[model samples]
Target: MVFWVPILSYAAVILLTAVAVLRAPAPRPPHLAANALLRYLNLFPVGLMGLWGALGHIVFPARSAAAIGWATSPFQTEVGAANLGIGLAGVVAAFYPNWGFRAGVAVVTAGFLGGAAITHVVEIAETGNLAAGNAGPILYTDVLTPLLLLILLALTYRSARGPAA
Candidate 1:
C-alpha cells in the first residue's frame, strides 16, 4: 500500500494536467514571450537534477543510496530545475492561456518521464533488481517524480483552458 500510494498520486496529477491543457486557449504573443523567458531560466535547475541523478547512479553504485544521495547531487538539482520550469509554465499559462505555456509544460514533463524511464531500464538491466525490495530511492526519483510531473502538466493545461481568471 505504501509503495502504491505514490504511484496513484502521480497518476492523478497527470490526469488532471491533461484535462487542463486540453481546455486551454491558443498562444498569445505576450504570454509566449513571458513563457519563453521562464523556460530559459527553468532549464538550469532541471539540468542540475538530471546531472545529479546521473552522478548518483555512477558514484554510489547502490540503488537506494544513489537515490537518497541524489537529493544533494545533480539529480536533485535537475528536479529543482524542472520544478521551476513547470511551476513557471503553470503560472504563465494561467495568466496567458496560450500554446507556449502548454508546450513548455509538455517539454518539461517529457524530459522527466524520458529520463526516469531510461534510468530505470538501465538499472534493471545492469543490477537485475527493481527497487531492491522497496527500500530504495530509485522508485521515488525514477517512478514518482515523472508520474507527478505528468499529473501537474495535465492540471496546468486544464487550468489554462478553464474560464479565464
Candidate 2:
C-alpha cells in the first residue's frame, strides 16, 4: 500500500491525460500533450507524492522507518523537510507553467529522487534490506520518475521551439 500509492497515482494521472488527449481530435497539437504531461507529472507524482512522503516521515516516522527496515532517527525529520520543499516546488511548477522554472523544478526533483534511489540501493546491498518501502515500487519510482520528467521536458522544449530554421 505504501509503495503503491505514488506509482498508482502517477500512472493514473498520466493514463487519464493520455486518454483524454488521444480522444480529442485527429490533429492534436504536439506541444499540448507535452505541456499537459509536464503539469500532471509534477503535480501528482512529484508534488503529491513528496507531500505524502513528508507526512509519512514527519508524522509517522516510526512506521516509515520500519517500512524501510531502519531504526527511527532525527534524520527522518530532515528527510521530511526535504520532501516538503520538493513537494512545494513541484506544485508551484505545475501552476506556473514556465519552461525554465519547470526545468529547475525537474532538476531539483531528479536530484532528490535520484539520490534517494541510490541510497535505497546501498541500503539493500549493505544490509540486505528487502522491506517493501526499501526495495519495491518506491525505489523504481525514485529512479524512473526523474528520467520520465527529463524526457517530457525535452519533448516540450522541442515542441515549443517550432520547426528547424
Candidate 3:
C-alpha cells in the first residue's frame, strides 16, 4: 500500500484530468489541455502526494522505513519536513498558475524527486534493497513525474509565446 499510494495517486490524477479536459467545452483557449494537466498534476500528484509522504515519514516513521527497507531514524523527520515544504509549494503553484512560480515549483519538485530516485537506485545496487517502496511504483514515479511536469511546462511556455515568428 505504501508503494501503491504514489502510483495510484499519480495515475488517478492524470487520468481524471485528461477526462476533464477532453469533456470541456470546445473553442478552448490556447494550451487548454496542457494548462489543465499542469494544474492537476501540481495540485494532486505533487501536492497531495508529497503531503502523504510527509505524513507517513513523520507520523508513521517505522512503517515508512520498513517499506523502504530501512531502519527508522531521526532523518525521517527531516525528510518529512522537506516533503511538507515542497508539497505546499506545489499546492501554491496550482492556485497561482503564474509561469515563473509554476516553473520554480516544478524545478524544485524535480530536484527532490530526482534525488530520491538516485537514492533508491543506490540502495538497490549497494544494499540489494528491493522492498516495495524501494523498487516499486514509487521509484518510477519519482523519475517520470518530473519529466512530465517539465514537458508540460515547456509546452505551456511555447503556447504562451504564440506561433514562431
Candidate 4:
C-alpha cells in the first residue's frame, strides 16, 4: 500500500488529463470560454505535480539530493531547469491546443524523462544499486510522470489531428 499510493495517484492524474483532453468541447470560440476551461482542467494537475516534484527536490534535500547529485550540483541544476521547463510547458499547453503547443509539451517531456533516465544510470554506476532508496521517488516523479504525460499528449494530438496530420 505504501509503495503503491504514489503510483496510483500519478496514474489518476494521467487518466484524468487524458479524459479531459479527449472530451474537450470543440475548440471553437473567442479562445476564452470552454477551451480555457478544458485546458486548465487537463493540464493543471500535471503542472502541479511537476512543481511539487521540483519543490520536493529542494525541501526534502536528504531524500532528493542524491538523485539529482545535490541541490547545487551541475546535475541537479540541469534537472531543475528541465523540470521548470516542463512545468511551464504544461501551463502553456493548458491555454493553447495548437501544434506548436503540443510540440513544446513533447519536447519538454522528453527532456525531463531523458534527464531522469541519465541520472538513474549515473546513480547505478556510482552506487551499484539500481533501486537507490532516494532515487525511487525521483524516478516516479521525473521518469514515470513525464512518460505518462507524453502518452497523453500523443493521444490528444492523434485525436485532434486525425490520421493524416
Candidate 5:
C-alpha cells in the first residue's frame, strides 16, 4: 500500500530521467545538440513528475488519497487537478523552452515541490506520518528535484552566456 507510492515515484523519476538523458535531441551540429540536451533535460522529467503527481489522484481519487494516508476527499481532487495543471504547464514549457516559459515552469515547480517538502516535514513532526508515500525516500525528491531544476535553469542561462561568463 504505502510502498507502492515510493516504488511508483522512483520508477517514474528514473524512467523520465532516462528519457531526458538517452533521448536527448540530436538535431544536428554540436552546440545546438547541447542546447537540445539541455532542453530535454530540463523539460521531460519535470513534466513527467507533474503528470505522475496528477494522473492517479485526479482519476482514481479515492485510491490515490488512501495511498498517501489521506481521506478520500475533495482536497485530494483539488490537489490532483493542481498537479495536472502544473504538469500540463511543464509540457507546454518543454515544447516552448523560451526564457519566459521555461523560467515560469521552473519557478512554479520549485515552489510546488518546496511546499510539498514542507508538508512532509510538518506531517512528520505533527502526526508522525512515516508512510513510504509520505515520509519515505521519495520525500527527499520533494526537496531535491526542485533544486536540481533550478540548477538546470541556471545551466540554460549559462549556456546562453556563450561559455565565457
Candidate 6:
C-alpha cells in the first residue's frame, strides 16, 4: 500500500494534467496541449522527491535511514533541505514561457538525478548493496525520469520553433 502511493501520486498528477490539456481551448495548435502538459509535468518529480526527502528526514528518519543503509542524523536533514530547495527552483521554472528557464531547471534537475543513478550503480557494484530500497525502482527512475523530461523539453522546443528553424 505504501509502495503504491508514490506511483499513484505520479499517475494522478499526469492524468489530471492530461484532462486539463484535453479540455483546453480547441482552437489552439495541436502541440499546444502537449506543450502545456509537459510544462506542468516537468515539476512533478522534483516536488515528489523533495517532499519525500523532507518528510523522511523530519518525521520518518528510521525508515529513510534504513532505505539507504544510513544512520539517522543531521545529514538526512541536510539532504532534505537540498531536495526542497531544488524542488522549489523547479516550481519557479514552471511559470516561465521561455524555454531558457525551463531548460535551465530541467538540466540541473536531470543532472542531479543522473548523479543519483550513478551513485546507485556504484553502490551496487562496489558494495553489492542489493537492497530493494537501494537499487530498486527509484534508481532506474532517476535515469528514466530525467530522460523523459529532456525528451519533452526537446519536443516542446522544436514545436515552438517550427521545422524551418
Model 5, which residues run further than 4 Å from truth?
1-44, 161-165
Top candidate, metric TM-score: 3
The backbone clash count of each candidate, in order, is: 27, 0, 0, 0, 0, 0
Worst 10 residues of 5 by lDDT: 28-37
All candidates' TM-scores?
A: 0.39, 0.90, 0.91, 0.57, 0.73, 0.78
lDDT (Cα, tens digit) per residue for candidate 5, span 88-110: 88777767857567777778878
Candidate 6 ranges beyond 4 A from true positions:
159-165
Candidate 3 local lDDT, residue 110 = 95
Whole-model lDDT per candidate = 0.46, 0.88, 0.88, 0.55, 0.67, 0.69
- Give per-residue lDDT, candidate 1, residue 37: 33
lDDT of candidate 3 over 1-165, digit per residue (tens):
876787778777778778978788997766888888898888877898889889989999999999999999999999999899888988898888898898999899999999999999999999999999998988988998799899999989976566781
lDDT of 5: 0.67
- Better model by lDDT: candidate 3 vs candidate 4: 3
Estimate, for each residue in 3-87, the C-alpha lDDT of model 1 and write its tens digit: 4433444444445445544555766433333333333222322333444434434554355243432223445445455545555
Q: In candidate 2, list every pair of residues with a backbone clash.
A: none
Runs with alpha carbons beyond 4 Å of true place in candidate 1 = 1-5, 8-75, 87-96, 132-165
| lDDT of model number 4 | 0.55
Tens digits of lDDT, candidate 6, 1-165:
224434664686588678877778777676675566565655566655656656776678778777765567877777677667767766665565677777777788788779878987998999998665567766766777678768878878877677786
Worst 10 residues of 4 by lDDT: 28-37
Off by over 4 Å in 4: 1-9, 14-46, 58-63, 66-78, 130-137, 162-165
Candidate 3's displacement at residue 39, Å, is: 1.0
Q: With candidate 5 superimposed using the best TM-score fit, by how many Å does residue 90's alpha carbon deviate from the native? A: 1.4
